[model samples]
Target chain A: MQALNQILRRIPVWAVYLLGAIPAPWLFYQGLTGSLGVDPIEALEHRYGELALQLLIVVLAISPLRRFLGLNLIKFRRALGVLTFVYVSLHLLVWLILDVQVPSQIWADILKRPYISVGMAGFVLLLPLAVTSNNLSVRQLGPRWRSLQRLVYPAAVLGGLHYVMQAKGFQIEPLVYLSVIVGLLLLRVPFPSLLNRFRQVDSA
Target chain B: GVGLAGMARGAAAQEALEPNSWEEITSYNNYYEFGTRKEDPAKYAHTLVTEPWSVKIDGLVDKPGEYDFQDIMSEMTVEERIYRFRCVEAWSMVIPWNGFELADLLNMAGVQDGAKYVAFETAYRPDEMPGVQYPVLDWPYREGLRLDEAMHPLTIMATGIYDRPIPNQNGAPLRLVVPWKYGFKSIKSIVRVTVTDVEPPTSWNVAGPREYGFYSNVNPNVDHPRWSQATERPIGGGLFAKRIPTLMFNGYEQEVAGLYEGMDLAKNY
Candidate 1:
């Protein structure tokens, strides 16, 4: 674990950002070349959203990975968060510009559809976290920034819900995403303490 | 994606209706028996042995027998039809289908007096169909239509696309094509078509009763529980194509609206 951390430290945070940027453009190139199958727009949208969820899971795993396994790769969490936001933004743009082009329908969908509504809400929550995912904001806000970034918990859950809701039928993929997100969240909160709190609440 | 013919150009009004090329019509379809993905059907459906296929047409039919594919083709008068195929998943395709009307097929089978609905079932060969291994909406995918809807001139039992034998992925030897309804209602690779008194359970409706209804008529006014079915992105339009407003009864309202007279479409939906 110590050896792994030493190697991870040697790799600069910019490396994470650079590596993260690759998938988005690679996906775009695939879409542009007509390689992303019959419906490129839908494929691109799903890919971007899935990538965002994947990164979110990774970011969520960091703390537990360090606390439980002693594999500290904390320096790259911000980069992962920013990259997740980038994919999320790309997914939204594809839906807005390419998939659902009508201006009226955009607002209607976000307002009316629970899945879209939750997805938009998740995006909104991520907006501030993304903006503050920097060295300057980290220094200025200190402990408060950590609290603000914790908004990812609800955002991640919403993102998973959005995925599950949008799926046509009972698809295992989306449910797996939601379960992983919830599982990671449960890992973050101490299980025994949570159980005790729940018991106390029940007794009260 | 190769061999894609150029854009659907409206050259002449009749010739203008040539919306999709042979490649577009053959590839990119939802045959869940093959797999759920659009490409899955084209990839996996090849395993299906379409040669010497037969359909067991029973239930209320006087001539209830396993009709051989070749014999059915020889008996029926096949014709070309350029129809707009709309999926429940908000995607559209213009397919040049070659088949005879379902009405003619039903008449040949001799629709008995008690026949109220026609329930169609897709072939569920787990060995041929890798997707049937997974319980994705009950195996041997089923779909149904009202006796009137089934007998509609527009309701065709498509055997071919682009005047060629229908590819295994695109339902091969025989399939249903009710243009007025969503694509799922047009069950693919049909083996059994039963005419009965009761409204038989459809695959999608059976799976997600609230989301997918029995009468899945393309109505822009009626919204899906999850998303608005008001618009659909045409498949041939490529990536940059914007979604167009979904037409009522998929532009077959003139022909099919009379079928649902005095019935609340929204309630049924």
Candidate 2:
């Protein structure tokens, strides 16, 4: 575990960015070579959406990992966040350009479909976070930046809900993902005070 | 009665427009009774007991009884037909089906004068089909057709595909195959057939009336509210292959269009 931490510490943020960017071209190659099953467009769209969700989960885990395990991955969090936004954008683009080609129909879907509306809501919340990810915006916004970035919590919840609602029937995989997200959110609750209360009760 | 040799000759003679691979046809299915995934039925449907199967022919039929599957097969003459099977979800496949016309079966059952519709019920075996445990849909999936639609020459009671007995996943023993309507209208693994005067309630229409109408004829002009039906992806076509434009009545307009004469298809849809 110590050696693993040392290796993680030595890895540069740029390396994380490069690794994250690799899937994009690999997916494109899969598309070109007809390796993405019968419905390629749908496959590509699903892959991007899943990748984005997975990255968001990783981002949510970073803080808990740092606090409980002393694994500080703070430096790469920004890169991970940026990669999540990229994948989410690509997912949306695939739906827009490939799946639903009609402009009017696209607007109708965003307005009418509950899943699409929630997914769009998540994307909208992430937009400002993507824009203000730089050091300049952090310095300018000062203390308010942290409060604004707290929108990630709700955005992640919406993303999970979107996945659950889109399925035709009860599916366990999406439910598992939503449960994990909920668990991560629950872990964020301040638990040190509860631990102290338990310690006091034991002593008394 | 047509012999098995004649049936084989008929199957060999029919021209298939776009023959789907046997692997593709057998592997992918939408048998929600087994499960929702396209591949689930292929994995789970083998548990379904097909032998000793019987279909209850009741309601307005003169001869109402549980007819044995083997007896039904023995009485009828089988032939082959190549048809386009289009799904409501905008995907399609061309399959060569082997069976007899449903008209012959209905005639043999002696449809009473009052019968206006033919209702079908799929087998509800929870032990065999795990999906039946969930309320994904009302149990014992049901579908219906107007008496005329049921009697149409294109409508067949398919027992096999690709000149072989259809696997359980693809509705073994017996199933209805309505060539023009969306594939869901072709009820699978049927256990009952009722000829009734009233228009029967269909499973999908009952689940969501606004989304799935009683008449699910394939018309590209009428979009499915959630997705456009203008084009369809053919199963087994390479991932990057361009979607082909969907045809009206799935290219059977000439054969089935007259059945809907003087009716507003858009409203009925």
Candidate 3:
């Protein structure tokens, strides 16, 4: 674990940001070249949203990974969060400009459809976090920044819900995503003292 | 009113009438019995054995027997129809389907006075159709139409596309093509077609009553619970292409609107 942490420490956060962003343009090029399949726009949109969700899951895992395994990826979490936001923005752009097209219907869909509404709400929650994901804001806000960043918990939950509600039928993929998000969120909550006592009893 | 070829959807239709390539037509499909993804059918449908294809015609019809595909083809006239294929998922395409009017086959079978609905069922081979094993839908994908809608000259049992034998991915050998209705209404790889007095249960409608109604005729005014049906992104259009407003009854309103005179489209949708 010490060796792995040392290795992780040597890896530059900028490298993580650079490597994570390759998919954004590569996916677009694939769509442009007809490699994304028959419905390239849809494929592109889905891929970006999926990438965002997957990164969000990874972001959620960082704290747990450090606590349980002593493998700290704390340095890369901010970069990962920013990259996730970029993918989410690309997903929304593809839907708005490329897929949906009509200006009137754009607001209509975001407001009317439950999945879109939830996704939009999630994006709205993440706006301040992305804006304040800097060194100066971190120092200025201090403890308040910690509480504000906690908004990611609900934002990620909403992202999972959006995915769950969008599928045509009862799809297991989206349900699995939602379950993982909820499980990770549960992990962050401190277990009751009574439960800790029971655990000590079992060990004894 | 003998197909869109004669009925004519006008100049705007013509502007959009360059049929999507055979590759696009076959590759992108929604035959859920094969799988749920748009590309799933193309990937997995080749396993289906369409050689000894037969359709069981029964219910209120006079000739109620299992008819072989070749025998059925020998008795009918086939023609090419250019149609605007609209999916309930807000995608659209132009397809040139070659087949005969469904009315001809129903007529040959001899409809009884009691007949009110025409129900069709797709082949359900769990060994061949991998998607069926998971029960994504009630097996043997089902679809139905009002007797009048079935007899409409526009409705066809498409056998081929682009003058080539239809590929298994595109519901080869046999499939229904109701140009005005959402693509799912046109069930694929059909094996059973029954005529009855009662309205038969349709797979999608049975699955979600609130979302998909029995009458799934394309109506821009009626939005689906999940997405707007007001416009559709035409397939084959490049990434930046804008969505066009969806036509009422998929530009077949002039021909088939009389079929639902007193009924409310929003309620039915």
Point to the candidate with the largest TM-score: 3
**Which whole-number lDDT from 0 to 100 does residue B79 have in model 2?**
83
Docking class of 1: medium
Best-matching candidate per DockQ: 3
User: What are the lDDT scores of the predictions, listed in order?
Assistant: 0.87, 0.87, 0.91
**Alpha-carbon interface RMSD for all candidates, in angstroms:** 1.5, 3.2, 1.2
Model 2 chain B: worst 10 consecutive residues (lDDT sum): B7-16
lDDT of 2 by residue, B38-94 (tens): 768988999999998999999999899999999999988888777889999888888
Alpha-carbon lDDT of model 2: 0.87
Residues A1-204 of candidate 3 have per-residue lDDT tens digits of 999999999999989999999999999999999998878999999999999999999999999999999999999999999998999999999998898888898899888999999999999999999999999999999999999999999999999999999987656779899999999999999879978899999999
True contacts kept of each: 0.62, 0.29, 0.54
Worst 10 residues of 3 chain B by lDDT: B2-11
Q: lDDT of model 3 at residue B231? A: 88
TM-score per model over all chains? 0.92, 0.82, 0.96
Please list the residue runs of candidate 3 whose C-alpha ends up more than 4 Å from where it truly belongs after superposition: B1-5, B9-16
Tens-digit per-residue lDDT, A137-159, candidate 1: 98999999989999999999999
**Model 1 stretches astray by more than 4 angstroms:** A192-204, B1-15
Residue-by-residue lDDT tens digits, candidate 3, B1-269? 34445566552555557899988888888887777788999999999999999999999998999999999999999998888899999999999999998999998899999899999999889999988877567777899999999998889999999998889988888999999999999999899999999999999998888889999999999999989998899998867767889999998887889999999999988
Error of 2 at B172 (Å): 1.9
